[model samples]
Target: MSLPDELYNAKFAEYIDSMKIMYLVDDRFKMICDDYCISKVNAEKFRQKIERDFQHQLKHENLSKELEEEILIYIMKNI
Candidate 1:
């Protein structure tokens, strides 16, 4: 699977080494990376909106956080 750029972004970039390892061996890890990227993009879009949708922005932010936690946990366990 192609790694998502979000995985290399500042937020999770430190885990790139571990993530790349898991990403190559586990499909689920790749899915989580994909989800994180999507949620991040959505959150940014909401942030940039002139008429902001705070609810949606918060939702995406929360999802991103949860997914980030999961990724961290997975990396730690598998590393």
Candidate 2:
């Protein structure tokens, strides 16, 4: 199944915004994009990989749901 460009772009923007906020909070917080040294193309598989990796790290860190959601919302609003 293929995803439309609009959906991909929106999700990519959201992911980038979220990552920027995460970076601001923790300079050590690394993303797959950084690790792979690859450009973001907004592909569905790439999006899923990013989301999965982020969620895994968040879970491992035991970060609070409220804090995560707040950061995400703040990023969405401000960026």
Candidate 3:
């Protein structure tokens, strides 16, 4: 399966190949990637609303980072 576009632009893009393999073989990993993609998309929206609602923007930023870390750790363990 093709990954969400956000995955390619993320900081952990370097490990994308591993992520893809995991995504294809592991249902949990695929769910994680889907969640990560949703979190990232929401974070991007929040970033645009930074001036209107800084708190939510900050919250999403932190959540996005956490999800990114989770993906990285998952990939590492499976790789």
Report the error of model 3 at residue 44, Å: 1.0
Model 1 agreement with the true structure over 8-49: per-residue lDDT tens digits: 877767888888889888989888878988998998887778
Local error of candidate 2 at residue 68 (angstroms)? 19
TM-score per candidate: 0.53, 0.27, 0.56
The sequence of per-residue lDDT tens digits that candidate 3 reaches over residues 25-49 is: 9999899989998998999887778
Please provide, for model 2 over 40-67, each residue's C-alpha lDDT reduced to its tens digit, 9 standing for 90 to 100.
Answer: 3436578899999999998967767777
Q: Is candidate 2 or candidate 3 better by lDDT?
A: 3
Lowest lDDT sum, 10 consecutive residues, model 3, at: 47-56
lDDT of 2 at 6: 39
For model 3, the stretches where C-alpha displacement exceeds 4 angstroms are: 52-79
Consecutive 10-residue window with the lowest summed lDDT within model 1: 46-55
How does model 2 fare in lDDT?
A: 0.60
Off by over 4 Å in 2: 1-42, 63-79
Best by lDDT: 3
